[model samples]
Target: EAGVVQSPRYKIIEKKQPVAFWCNPISGHNTLYWYRQNLGQGPELLIRYENEEAVDDSQLPKDRFSAERLKGVDSTLKIQPAELGDSAVYLCASSFGRGRSNNEQFFGPGTRLTVL
Candidate 1:
């Protein structure tokens, strides 16, 4: 079937503006994840969802970043009052099962956000 889908492939906004991203995972996948990747660095997990429940989100900056997965299918991530330091690639990935050791995650093209 299809891989993950994300919208607004690219976005440019001034500092303090609000930005949101959308994601649709492959059918039959039970796990979803959101990650932020900085230039020259690997992706960092922002949140992980097992079904509609958020199982891991310790790394998410609750002050400005928030995410949700409804009915265990699609998800959305939002950043309010964006900061220059928040500019990065936001990725959405999905897999068949929970945890990272057993399954392979399929990633979307990602939404590149730029804050000026």
Candidate 2:
């Protein structure tokens, strides 16, 4: 089985600029999640998708952040007009079940965004 994949492991952008990240979940996994980890902080769920439907997205900042999982196999997160405070690690995780517990999630290394 393949592990999760992400591109541009690091990014640097000016405030108010736009940035985007990509992720490809593990094969056969039915649940995918996007999380944000501020420096020295644990990951906070940004959005979660079960198959094709977005099960959770309340934590996402609609003002400048957006995400999508078109085929339920891969996802992308975009930040338009990025803010300096948006600098953080964007992680993509996947699981076999949709439960909110340990072991279910296998996290990617994360895309580290540095807003200047």
The prediction achieving the highest TM-score against the true structure is: 1
Q: What are the runs in model 2 whose C-alpha is more than 4 Å off?
A: 99-103
- TM-score of structure candidate 2: 0.94
Clashes of 2: 0
lDDT of each: 0.94, 0.91
Specify the highest-lDDT model's number.
Answer: 1
Q: Write the per-residue lDDT of candidate 1 for residues 41-109, one digit (tens) a residue.
A: 999999999999999999999999999987889999999989999999999999998866369999999
Question: Residue 46's C-alpha lDDT in candidate 2?
Answer: 95
In model 2, the Cα lDDT at residue 49 comes to 91
In candidate 1, stretches whose alpha carbon ends up further than 4 angstroms from where it belongs are none
User: Please, what is the TM-score per model?
Assistant: 0.96, 0.94
Model 1 CA lDDT for position 65: 96
